[model samples]
Target chain A: MFEIKDLKASIEEKDILNGLSLTIKPGEIHAIMGPNGSGKSTLAKVISGHPDFEDPEGDIKLDGKDILDLEPDERANEGVFLAFQYPVDIPGVNNSEFLRMAYNAKQKYQNQPEIDPFDFESLIKEKLTVLNMKEAFLSRPVNHGFSGGEKKRNEILQMLMLDPRVVILDETDSGLDIDSLKQVSDAINHFKSENKMILIITHYQRLLNHIVPDTVHIMADGKITKSGDKSLALTLEDQGYDAFKDNQS
Target chain B: MLSKTTNPKTMELETLQKQARDAFNTLGFPTKRHENWLYWTPDNEQKALERKFYEPSDSIKENDVILIKNGSLRSKPNNNNLTVSNDTHDYQNENLSFNLDSSSLSYLNTSECSEVITIRCRGIINEPLQIRLESDHTKDNSTVNTKVNLIVEEHSSITATFYHQQLGGAFNLTNTSFELVCKDNANVNISHVFKDNKSKAFFHSIIHMHEKSNCNHISYVTNSLLTRHDTNVTFYKEEASLNLKGINLLTGEEQFYNHLTINHKSKNCFCKQHFKTILDDKSISEFSGLVYVAKGSHEVDSQQMNQILLFSDSARALSRPQLKIDADDVQCAHGSTIGQLNPEEIHYIKSRGLTESEAKALLTYGFAEEIIEEIQDSHLKEALAQDIKETVRKIKS
Candidate 1:
């Protein structure tokens, strides 16, 4: 299970996530719909251990263990993965090499035998084929000159390779075209498992339409104001976030 | 310089040496007040200037390899097609001369140089001539003076590599002067690799390009200590092109300064200067290049740029990419960029489970790939790639 208990966070003394709480049991997909500044992305950053935010004040427990004290890499090694909203561009690092290094890092953390480049090659190629990325993509620098859709697909590729227990998708559908959105959603669906917990944070209900979340949460002023079945996303889509502005306590 | 007798050549050299000695006496050592000598923090490097001139062995065996150790000839194979001589008369093409007064070290080289090696190439040579410069570390706090002349005759094509070995003894000083002459329609490719000098080192090189000649040069610097380079390339005739680039990967208090001046004396020439620096720890580096196109040199094209990547907050990068154009109808552009490792980029890599140091090492290596891929020699490129991987691993360890 992945759980955030009253997650209170801030940036530069400005409160962003004020007492926000959510929980997703194993085999569940939770979609978070909110307005622009409603702390959805902040939730992702806090979970991924971004240094920009202030030291969070609540517990972020992964499988009953609080990970507030862990470094970003340690949290990642401990099965926390956040696919960024705006993926960074690493100008000179080869995509294949970066993926291999990330895989080996996980392997080393788990005290398992690390995979060499030659052995890891076929495994990554399989993921690349599944994502429909060309072979030339491996030779390019990681997201350096990639288009918007390519960057999103690269994030999905990373999630597939890392195989984390807790997956946080932060606005992975914004810059993607309709075709890319469907393809990336199909990839996420293919990656779903009964042992994993997925958190989908988005502004619209379009992504939820494809992924069909188990639950929908309406967030406002840094906290969740309402929670219900997947049909709640349809309601928010039809009525807009104005319906929840006055409902938060 | 058309004297057929050997005595006139000797006398000409002797008189030139006398003039150089007088010049050095009048100029002495440069101070911080001089514009060109600004970044020089003198740590008692006057010993090199005060050392007595040493005698050089003249037994010339023409080997493909010319080895010089502390201003003494170690090996020269006679089997190669190159003509190695002590004479400097025909070594120069029409009205060409080494700019000895450009730097104080050039004056020091002319005054104290005991031996001079001149290699003349007349045709296309596939094999690269190797000039290995090593330091004799048996003695403590020593000084060395060495010089070389390379002349490529008309319609000739040649390649050469000047390899500077790692100096590993008591701190000392060295002054070296190198000159190259390219005649009409000549093509020359040269590489200078300087590594781990234990003390102060000053090196100067002047290249004179004649009509329709093209020269490609690259300098690879790593692990240097208080080193300075003065490189000058002058276009003596029209339709010549000079491509010069340098990569300096420095760490741990190493200071490197490179001053490059490209002078276009004739019309219809192209010149380029691209330099990159990857600095770590508290190392310091500066790239000051000046491109001056004379009034009559119309239709000249030149480009200059410097990119610096610093790893530590204490590391400093100084860039001075200046241009002086007295002529109209020319194309020139110069700019510089100094940036640190992006934290967001670091977080993205860290989110993938790699440690911070590993992310840093990978990104830093990628930063230098732009220049590393520019190397035309495959073996050298592979070796350098491996070398940089090791160097990056040692950072913050």
Candidate 2:
């Protein structure tokens, strides 16, 4: 289980996540929907332990252990994965090589044996089929010259490869087209397991239609003002965040 | 009677050598005052003119490999279409005379070299020629001068690989000059691998191309204390093309300099030059390339690019790409870039699970792989790739 209690994070002396509290148990997919500047993405970043954020208050626990003090890679090794909204392009690093390194790092952290190149190749080739990616994509540099939809698919591709315990998808559906959206959603759905927890932070309710969440929370002004079942997302789609914003005040 | 029977070509070469010697005496060694040599200046302790010459004491008798030790050819392969001669005999081609006047180092090489090693290719040569230039391990501070002449006749194709290695740790000064001529419809490829010891090396090469000839020149430099390479190419006829590529990997306190000049003196010629360097520790690298398109040389395409990656705070790079176009219809472009590895890129790689050192090694290897991928010889390509990976490992550790 992943838990956050009164998490107040700031960057450059400006508070982005103000007294936010949430709990996600295994086998539950929760979606956080809010308007612009409502701190949804900041919450995801704080969960992933981004170094840009200053001293954060409260506790972020993974299986009852405080993880806020861990480095980004350390958090990742502890089964925390964040699919960045903007994937960085690293020229000259082959995608397959990068993926192998990442996978082996996690394996070593878990005290597991490293995967041989041939075995890793077979594993990645299987995952590539799930995302409908061509074999040539493995040879190209990481995220270099990739289209918007391709970059998103690559993020999900990484998610599948790592298979972390807590998966945070921050706006993974913003720039994706309908076809790519369907493909990415299918990949995410395929990765869902009974022991894994998913946090989807989005501005619109469109992505929730593809991968229906167990619960929906409406955030405004750096705080979650409303929480309910999946039908709340439908109501928000009909009434808009303005109705909730007025109610919060 | 012997004077009457003297070869006119040999007499002309003697006169040219005398002229070159006079010019060398007047110009002397280069200094910071010379515009073309502003970045490199010899130390006062190292005098180019007052050094002793040593004869070679080691030789390799391999069949496919020609070994040149201490400025003398010790072995050659027997082939029907190729000829190797140590003595200067009637090699005064017009192409050799066109591109040797740009630098005083070439003149010095011409003046001081005792014997010239000439390799002439006539018909199609099936095998690549491997030439190894090695210094004797006598533990003495001496200077060696070597001159090589390569001639490719019409309708022939050949590949040559030159490996330079030093066997001792003395203050060795090496001055090497190469004259490459490709006749009409000939195809030639030359690869130079410089893996010298802690010695100072100065190399000058002049290339001339005839009608419809194609030439490719590739050089790799690594592990030299102080090195400078001066290359000049001229298109003497129409429809010729040239491709020049180089890579330099420097670490520790090494210093490397490359100066390239490409002259398009004819119509419908093409040229491309790409050079990349990786500098680590407190090393420094410099590149200056110039492309000149003379008048009436229309329909010419040229491109020059130089890129450097600095891995340390003290590492430095200076790059200058200049183009001079006098022709009306031509396409020319030049670009140069010097930068360190991107932090965001490194973070991204690290976030994916690699350690900081592993991430850096991967990025550095990727930078040099661009030039290594273009090598046509699989054996050479594999060897270079292994060398680059080892270099990255050494830097990280």
Candidate 3:
């Protein structure tokens, strides 16, 4: 289980996630929908322990244990993975090499033996099939000269490789074409399991139609104002977020 | 200082040597007043220049590889076409001239050199010729000077590699000069590897290319106490091309300097130069590159780029990429960039599970691999890459 209680986080003295509270249980896919400047992405960043947000008030717990003091990589080692909305381009670093390094890092943290290069190559090759990517993608630099859809797919590719317990997809659907959207959604569905939790944060309800979150929360001014079943996403789609501004808590 | 012409064969050479000695006396050592010698100069020990001649106690036998130890030729390769002579030739017809005359190092080298090793390639050479210049731990506070001349005939090709190594804690000074001439339709590839040395070394090279000649020059310098390399190229005829690339790795308090100049004196010539340096600790590096297109040399294309990566607050890098185009129809471009590693890139790599040091090593290796990958010889590339990796590891430690 993953839990965030009154998580008020600020950057440069301006609060972004203002007293936000949420809980996600295993086997459940929750979607947070909101208008612009409503802290959807900030909540995800705070959960992943971004360095910019300092001295966050309230608590974030994974598996009922406090993880507020962990570094970003430590959080990642603890099964907290955030698929960045904007993946950074790392020139001269081979994609497969980076992935293998990440995988080995997590393995070392868990006290497991590291995989050899040949074995890691085969392992990542299998994951490429899930994203319908070519072998050449592994040889190129990470996210360098990649198309928008390709970058998104690479994020999901990493998610699959790491197999984190808590998966936070922050606007992964934005800028993705319909075909790429379907492919990414399929990859996400394939990664879903009974012991894993997924949080999808987006401004549009279109992505929810593909992944079909079990619960939807309407956010405004950095807090969740209302919560309901999946049908709330369609209602917000038709009625718009303007209809929920009066319900801010 | 001209020894009484005991060898009649060198009487003409003695005259030229006297002229060179006079030139060195007139110009003397470079001072802060010289524009190109602004950042560095010979260490305050005036004895370095005074100890001009040191005879080697050991003699080298003849072998297939040219080996110079303590500034004396230890071995000479026995080849029919290769002429290893202690006498000087009238090299004026070879277009031997220094591009930057602010320093008298070249004149000093010419005046003090004991021999001039010359290799004339007629047909295509199947094997690469290797030259090793090594300074052992036997001597301290001494000076050694050597010179080489290479001429490639028409329709011939050859690859030459020079390995310079200095061992021990001696504060020796080494001065070297290389003069090359490429005839029409000849191909020449040369590589220089300067490895861990505690001595102060200065190298000056001049190249002249005739019509339809192709030349490629590559250099790698690793952890030298103080080193300066000067290379000048002149296109004597149309359709000649030059490709030059260099990488420097510096750490501790070491300093490395590179000065390159290309002169396009003919039409339809091309020249490209790329140089990169990685500095750590309190090391310093400087690069000065110039491409000149002479008058009436239209349709010339020249490009030069210099990049530096600094790893410490005290580490410094300076670069000057200049283009002097006198012809209106010529194309010239130059760019220089000096920056530290990107924090975001570092964070991104660290996010993948590498420690801070490991992340830095990987990034630094990646930065240098750009130039190493351009080397055509796999053996040379692999060896250079391994040396770079070792250097990167030391930086983190």
Candidate 4:
């Protein structure tokens, strides 16, 4: 289970996440819908231990263990994954080599013996096929010149390869065309299991149609204002966030 | 003997030599006051310049190697398409076309040089040629200075690698220079490498491009105490282009200095000079590249970029990329970047589970690959790729 309690974070003396909290049990998909600057992205960054929020006042635990003191990479190895809203371009870094390094890192972190690089290639090819990404994508520099849709698919490719217990897709649907959206959603559904936890952070209800969530939460002013079943998302999408904002106020 | 002395060609050579002697005597050595030698002019180098070096006596003619030691040609190939000579000729086919006072060292080389070795190419060479410039010292001889001239005749093509190595005592100086000429419709590619450790060295290359000629020059300079490279290029005719690139890898307390002057003097010419330097430990890299376009040289294109990567906090980088455009229809741009490994790049790699140092090493290796992949010759490209890999590995550990 993934849980956040009283998460209070600030950036450059400005409050961003004020007493925000959520709990995600195993075998559940939760979608966070919110207006811009409602701390949705900040919440994801705080969970993953971004350096900007160095000493956030909160309790972030995974499987009943407090992980607030962990580094970003440590959090990643601890099954916390954040698909960035805007993926950074790392020029000159080969895609396959980067994935292999990431995979071996998690392996070494878990005290498991490192797999041979040759074996890792075959493993990555399987994941690439599932994501429908070409083999040439593995040779080019990581996200250096990739199109918008391609970068989103690359995020899914990483999720498939690492198989983290907690997957946080932050705006992974924006800027993606319909075909890419369905493809990515299908892969996410395929990866879903009873032992995994998924958090989908998006503004539109379109993505939720493909990867249906069990619960929907409306975030405002850095904290959850309302929580309900799937139909609540349809209500908010139909009436816009203004209706939800009036109700919250 | 009297006829040899009275020949007009000999007279012309003797007059030029006399002028070079006078020029060297007047210019002497550059000091801190010289704008071009500011950061590199230490008083101790003057002592090294005064050291005496004797001439080499042995010679060997090989198939594809031009081997030289202490200003003397030791080996050259015996081929019909290639001719190696040191002869004085008429103005129409003269080998020396650069200014004598391009640098003070060039003047000294001209005055003290016993003979000028010219390697001329008349047709396409199937295999790439190798120029081996080496330095050695014993009880009798301890210092050396050498230079060579390369000429690609009209409608000819050639590829060559110039490798300079120093294997002398810790306290020695090696000075060398070369002048290359690409005649009308000629094509040339050159790869230069310098590996001199714990010693001081200076190398200069003066290049001239004629009508429709093209030149690609790449340099790999590293592993030296104090290394200085001075390159001067002049586009003398229309439709000529010069693509110059280099990589300087410095570690420990090593220092490398680069200075270039690119002059686009004719219409429809192109000039590009890009250099990347990697510095680690307490090393330093200094670069100054200037691209000049004359007033009437319209439709000329020129670009200059200097990128420096520092692996340590104490490493220092100084860069100056200057452009002086006098043509209205020309396109010219210059940029300089001095940075450590990208922080975002580092974070992205680290988030994938790599430790900080491993991430840094991988980025460093990749930075080198982007430049090495541009070389056209496969053999040279592979060799440089391996060399840079080993160098980066050493830097990482």
Candidate 5:
């Protein structure tokens, strides 16, 4: 249900994402593997409508509607969720309070009845079965002093709460221990359905072991150099990106 | 109109002015020239030169009195266990002194006064005492100086909220001298809110603590106009504790100045100071705090912090936190932070589906809550929260 064609995005005046293009339909999970500083996060930020990153030339459409002009919040309202690799530590704002406000804002934008605290608490508790996080995490400030794994799990919890149509995980597996990686993967897989699209951005293939993607895309410099089945990831893992350096997109 | 009454009226104004002018001239505006007032400076261009004493307007019915103005409690009419001694200039009360600057004055009033307002509860109060002091006139020059003495008896606890409401656009001076004696095992919390208008006003306050007394003082001063405020606190008894917090919320083309001093004179006394400031639209704020640890005051633990949020190019904050530790064995540290809003916090809040303005509003509210939560008064907290929201919105707009 999402499509990106020849995407070109820049931060300030520097070009980062050059002529990049990719697509994911309903029920599809795609892995975007790229090395450090390879414009992996920029793609996610551009799609999420981060104000500092602007798409100068490209088209991103959700269900056939262009979303380049939408503000970051508007993009989030349109069901685009980007799980940041390094979660921010928001001090003084209670976790539950933040969740409620966010959930209500999305609900109000979609013309749905807002969930009260009671319902929201129950909803989060029900979903916590996957992440197995403690109740105290909901009371403390969001992500402040949280373990790396806990931060990743918290992102998954937010994704489950928002239940976005297109979820972009920007290296969510990084910094997470093996156990946290499994929990995060399981949570994402649990939320995966025929009506949802998932784009996984990572530097390694370890997460693919738990949540297998339908397709894999290799990114170099600023463009998606290759796209194939899950075996493509295996091939890249074996030969490294050097094999595709000469035959770039 | 220059009748005998009118002439004496002028003479009274002149007499009051001379006393204050002399005191200030002698004190000589604690300046950067002086180490104590180094952080803040009043706008010399806009001075409250003329003083007009309005006849006490009994217009505010007794029922309208909220028992506390800003963070100071009312003690005259009903309660008995809470003894409020008068330390005003007219009374021959024991004088309390501090190393820093102080100005005291007295005025005549016919309003009813209470000797004791008892607060015997042992639990924390969710409704903080709110003292809203409105000027008697909208445009008349004025001076209001009074000493409010709060005494918490042994095995008791209470929280007082004070809101200094400057409703009129007139030049005014308000001096609130508070003395709180918390007996053994008693707890006292006080919150002070200084509301600013288009007038020039100067607020000076000094609070003293007794033996084994625990007192928390919080003040929020939002300046949209020119104002000068000073708060001095001293703890004299062993095992006593104090928490002093000040926040300066400012905007517009005004100069706001604040000088605070806390003195710890006894052994094992503890104190903490935190000041947060938000400035925009060419507004300037100067905040200076000094914590003095007397000799033999062993095991004294204290920390001070000043954080400023600059929202515009011309906004400024001059923060100086100084400490004088005569005791070799003491824990005293201070820090200052001057920066804009955390961009990541703003992005995180915005990504949660709130617009930029909405996200900023939440961040500013959260920043103020760090000190507001210590107030222990729900009504006062809510009122202060409302004021914070309004201030943030005003800055955003």
Candidate 6:
């Protein structure tokens, strides 16, 4: 459902992703593991249309349609979701109000009926039950005073609400505790179906234990160094990216 | 005679114009030499637009109460509690009278307006009165002056919205003065919205808050063309509190100057002033606030914060906060910030599903929402929000 060919991305004239390529089919889960500055998060941001992640040469497609020219919101409308590493803290904007606007924007783009306030409230409540988020969180400003775990969970909650066909999780497990990590994994597992594709981007294998990926790709120096089955993630957990760094030279 | 020859309409306005012109000629325009005008005075560079006079509109539609045309006063719709009992307020108390003797605005409004609308409320009104003053007619230079005095009885609470809506292509000068006599333990919310046209417009507003009364004034002035507004609010009496917030978001050659003074006469009084201005192109925004703590006025708390966001290199802002404390044991502090959008906030919002323009709009909206949300009336809040959004859209578009 997702494909990238020779993706090259940069920031402020500094190249981060050079000739990166990956593909994940429906019903499959993939994990991209790399060390610091290895372009793991850059890959995710590039796919999500981050303005800072400029693509000089590449083609990224979802379901056979080029998405390089689409805006971030337009990509989300096309069932592409990116779970940011750190959610923004927007004061004076109610969390529910932001969600409603985003939800309606996507719905309108997809030609679906917009949800009213009442129905939207109930819908958020139902999703909150799945993510174990408190009702008070809905009324507070977006991520204004949220803890690390809460921000991560809020990201997952958005993924669930939008129900994107191709989900890209960027460092989604970095700040989560064991319990919160399991909850987030459970939420992802609940949405796991035959028609959805998930890409988990992380440096550790802890998240892999909960939501096992069908394939593991080791990224180093802005390009994929190796790809294998789930055993590669386990081997990297025991060994680390040191093995891949040596192979690069 | 000069003003009349330039724009001849009615004998009433011509007579009033002659009277105002004679007053101005005798006592030239108030300058820095005058104590009251020391802190505020237009430079010689600002050419004076000719002031013309027109008939007042007293039509009483609920929506039209706030919508005055020409120089006439319109009653707030369904303001039964505000019985228009015609009685002039004795402006003199001790040696100080709010009524300025040689002021052209005071002379024109007091002499010409034989019938003054006395707006009073004993209980909370279901709908806050909306006063929309519209100026769409222009034969030559036009002038619209109004004096509205609001009195809230003891233990009464009400919210009133005063709107100055000007749309035309003539030089216009409008003056509005309000006296809010809030009896003990009364609360009043006053919101002023100024929507001026492409014509050269000048507006001056003065409000007085009385003893033990709580008053909140939210002023929003957006100049689509060339315009200037001067506002002053004074809080008198012990334990009386006031909040003064003003926002000027403008483009083109619009210029706005706002000066607020809080006179803490009695003990234990507090006041807060927060003003934000968004300027683009060659527009200018000026803010001046002074907190005066009189002798024996102990424990007076006051704070003033002015934040200006300049989106263009040519846009300018000047903010000055002055504090005078006669009492020793008082807390008074002031601060001003003038800068562009925070790069961190912009990046944060952009990381989400928003583009650069979309993220800037959201961040700027959040900054302005601080003052807009403090409005007590829901309808006014919505209207102000929509207006602000429209401004943002214009800036972005």
Off by over 4 Å in 3: B1-12, B43-45, B53-64, B76-93, B98-102, B125-129, B137-139, B168-170
lDDT of 6 by residue, A1-249 (tens): 789889998888888898988899999999999888989988887787766765557888999999988877677778888888988787778888878877877788778898988999999999999988889988888788899998899888888877889999999998999999999999999989999999999988889999999999999989998999989998988887787676641
iRMSD for each candidate structure, in the order shown? 0.9, 2.0, 2.0, 1.7, 1.4, 2.8
User: Given candidate 1, what's the lDDT at residue A232?
Assistant: 93
lDDT comparing candidate 3 with the true structure: 0.81
TM-score of B chain for each model?
A: 0.90, 0.92, 0.90, 0.92, 0.76, 0.82
TM for every model, in the order presented, reads 0.90, 0.91, 0.90, 0.90, 0.85, 0.81
- Per residue, candidate 3 scores C-alpha lDDT tens digits across A1-249 of 999998898989888888898899999999999988889988887787666776899999999988877777778888988888888787767888889889999999999999988888888888888888899998988898999888889999998888899999999998899999998999899999999999999888889888989889998888999999999999999999888878753
TM-score of 5: 0.85
B1-397 per-residue lDDT for model 4 (tens digits): 0122222233455666677667767887877799888887735656556564647545556746887776777778887788876554523255454346477776666666555677899999878888888777443223466757888999999988988887665467777778899999999998888865556777888999899999999988888787888998989899998889998899988888999999888989988888999999999888999999998999999999999988889889999999998888999999999988877676666666677777777788777777787687788888887787778878853
Can you rank all candidates by TM-score, best first? 2, 1, 3, 4, 5, 6
Considering only N, C-alpha and C atoms within 3 Å, which residue pairs clash in candidate 3? none
- Per-residue error for A3 in candidate 3, Å, reads 2.1
The reply for model 2, stretches above 4 Å from the true place, is A8-14, A42-58, A220-225, A246-249, B1-13, B43-46, B52-62, B123-128, B137-141, B167-170
Top model number, DockQ: 1
DockQ-better candidate, 2 vs 6: 2
Task: Give one clash count per candidate, in the order shown.
Answer: 7, 0, 0, 1, 15, 4
- Please say which candidate is ahead in lDDT: 4 or 5: 4
Docking category for candidate 6?
A: acceptable
Model 4, residue B169: displacement in angstroms? 5.5
Per-residue lDDT of model 5, residues B1-397, tens digit only:
0112222222333343344455554554334576544544433412332233333322223332344332234332223333332223322222323112343221111111221122233444434444454443354444443335455666667777656665555455443444455666668887776666655556655666667778888877776476666677777777878888776788877777777777777878888888888888888888777888888888889898988888898887787888888987899998988988787777777776878888888788777778877766777778777888888987763
**How many pairs of residues in model 4 come into backbone collision?**
1
lDDT of each: 0.83, 0.82, 0.81, 0.82, 0.70, 0.73
lDDT of 3 by residue, B1-397 (tens): 2333324233455565666677778887877788778888765524665565445526557798788765666787777656454434634335444222425777787677666655677778767788897766446666677677778889988887889887645467788787788899998888889888877888888888899999888998887898889888889899998888998998889998898889899999988898989988999998998899999999998999999998888998889999998997888899999988776666556555566677788788888877887776667888998888888878853
How high is the DockQ of candidate 4? 0.57
Instruction: Report RMSD (Å) for each prediction in the order shown.
Output: 3.7, 3.9, 3.9, 4.0, 6.4, 6.3
Which regions of candidate 5 deviate over 4 angstroms?
A: B1-75, B84-95, B98-132, B137-139, B153-155, B182-184, B196-198
Cα-based lDDT at residue A80, candidate 6? 87
- lDDT tens per residue, model 4, A1-249: 999999999999999998988999998999999999999998988887777888999899999989899877888899888888888777767889788888989999999988898899898999888888889999988888999999999989999999999999999999899999999999999999998899999999999999999989999989988888899899998988888875652
